[model samples]
Target: MNPTIELLNSHRSIRKYKSQPLPPGALESFIKAGQAASSSNHVQACSVIRVQDPSKRAQLAHLAGDQAYIEQAAEFLVFCADMKRNTEAAASTGIEPTLGMTEQLIVATVDVALFAQNVAIAAESEALGIVYIGGIRNNPSAISELLNLPEQVYPVFGMCIGYPDHQPEVKPRLPLEAVLMQDSYQEHEQAEQVAYYDQQMSEYYQARTGGNKTSNWSQSMAPMFGGKLRPHMRDFLIAQGFTMK
Candidate 1:
């Protein structure tokens, strides 16, 4: 495999970061790399807010489920899916813009995700560690308010970037066969594949935690499936002008 693929495959989320800051101009370069990602119809619907103020970072830390890393990391970035710019741009063309379609939400969300991943890859290449903070969705409305996000814009996620303070084991993913199907959708072997992956994950957790953690992939996913999912997102998204039609 090439160097880029090798770098990608070695990715691990770094929660503990060193006190050192990024080299001058590096953050801009990373954002530039992110901008180079493919945008849907060149809409460039993604926007990132670099949180530099300590007070704001502290507020975000509390809002994002008390994730102290947001305050500790050298840089914290909130990635947002934004159609406000595009909608206004379109309206400027002498036509009233219609917004709040479900597809529009998906497009902007996917655009932000793709853009953030590009930034992640770039940061990793430069020997920086990054951990994505999805907990921002815990209080999306509060986050939007803090960030001053307008209608047609919503916070999808946040990311922490800095020099790694410690190394962590790379977590395993689902088997190729389970995720990659042929032409049509197939799940004939999904259960078996997941079972095997569960065992592998169980061992990984056991070894990583020195027998403190003893849960498989399926077992760990229980909370997500067992009514622990964030249900407030639907109303929050709608309130944020992503009405999903």
Candidate 2:
């Protein structure tokens, strides 16, 4: 297998982090790696806010669903899906802030996530650990205020980075047959595939959490499908200068 593929297979979220600070130049190199990601027409519609102040980090942690790891990590980075620069560029010439269509939101998000993942992978190559904190959107309004984000810019997510305090087994993903689609899409075998994946995941969870089982896909998929997350997201986006029409 390829080296990148081997590294990808070992990917896992690290929640607990050691107190050690990153070595000199580590953060800079990570930023450089992020910039190397391909952008949409080189727009590079992403910006990172690195939080090192303990009090600020704590406030961000509270905003991110009270995840203590956000404050505990050696570094906290908030990646933003930004069109603020474009808004400026338009004013500089004769263009206008494009009221991004709902579908185009995916482009902004994918651009940001790709850069974030590049940084994560680069850091991991040097033995650093990271956890993507999607919960940052739990209180996006408050987070935006705290981060002093402008209109046309929104926090895509946060990341906690540092030396890992512990090593855990890789979480089980669905079998190749389940997700690796062929020429023609088929759903007939999904039931059996899910059952097998569920068992593998259940065992993996039990072992990771000291024999206490949390949930299986069937049990949690319902609430997730019901949109239990920030349901006012459309309204929120409008407030942030994104027209989802």
Candidate 3:
């Protein structure tokens, strides 16, 4: 197997870490790699906050569902979808940006993910391991305040980077057929595809928990979508100045 392919394929969340620190200049290289990601119209609506203070890291970990890993990371970064820089630029010159001005929220989200993934790949290439912290969204306001984020900017996610303490199994993903569609959208096969995916996900989750847990994809998605998370997200986005019409 190709070494590059192997690195991409073997990706998994690494929570635990060693005390070993990253080499000097490694982080700059990683940030450069992340900035190299493709952006729509070159907006590059991404910004990152590197958490260096121990107290701040601990507080962030507490805010982010008490995920201990966030504090343990040698480098913890909070990625944000930011339009402030662009807006500031436009306002300073007395001009407004073109269409989708309100949609910078979405663009920034993609930018954050692109940069985060790029950093992950670079970190892996350097024998380091990392974990993305989606739990940071659990309390958006708290995160924004903790990082002192300005308006028109929102925390998309957090990431933990450090030397690995353990190697976990790579999580399985949905089959390609479930995600890929034909030339024209076919509604008929969707249910079957979802059902197959549900079964695969159920088995995958169960295996991860040593057969102590069982949950189908449909069952798992409800809490994540229909539950409090969705309404809270809508509220959070609105408060963050993203008026989703």
**Top model by lDDT, which number?**
1
Please report, in order, the local distance difference test score of every candidate based on alpha carbons: 0.94, 0.87, 0.85
Q: lDDT per residue, candidate 1, 29-133, as tens digits? A: 999999999998999999999999999999999999999889989999999999999999999999998889998999999999999999999999999999999
* TM-score, model 1 to reference: 0.98
**What would the TM-score be for candidate 2 when compared with the true structure?**
0.94
State model 2's lDDT: 0.87
lDDT of 2 by residue, 1-245 (tens): 89988998898899999999999999989999999998877778899999998888989888888899999898999999987786687678976656667655766788899999999999999898999999888888988998899988999899999999989888878889988888977699899999988888777777878988777766657777876667867777889988877
Candidate 3 lDDT over residue span 22-104, tens digit each: 99999889999999998877888899899999999999999888999888878999989887787788778977654234466
Residue 159, candidate 1: alpha-carbon lDDT: 100
Q: In terms of lDDT, which candidate is stronger, 1 or 3?
A: 1
Estimate the overall C-alpha local distance difference test score of candidate 3. Answer: 0.85
Backbone clashes under 3 angstroms, per model? 0, 0, 0
Candidate 3 or 2, higher TM-score: 2
For each candidate, give its TM-score against the true structure.
0.98, 0.94, 0.89
Q: Which residue runs does candidate 2 get wrong by more than 4 Å?
A: none
Clashing pairs in 1: none
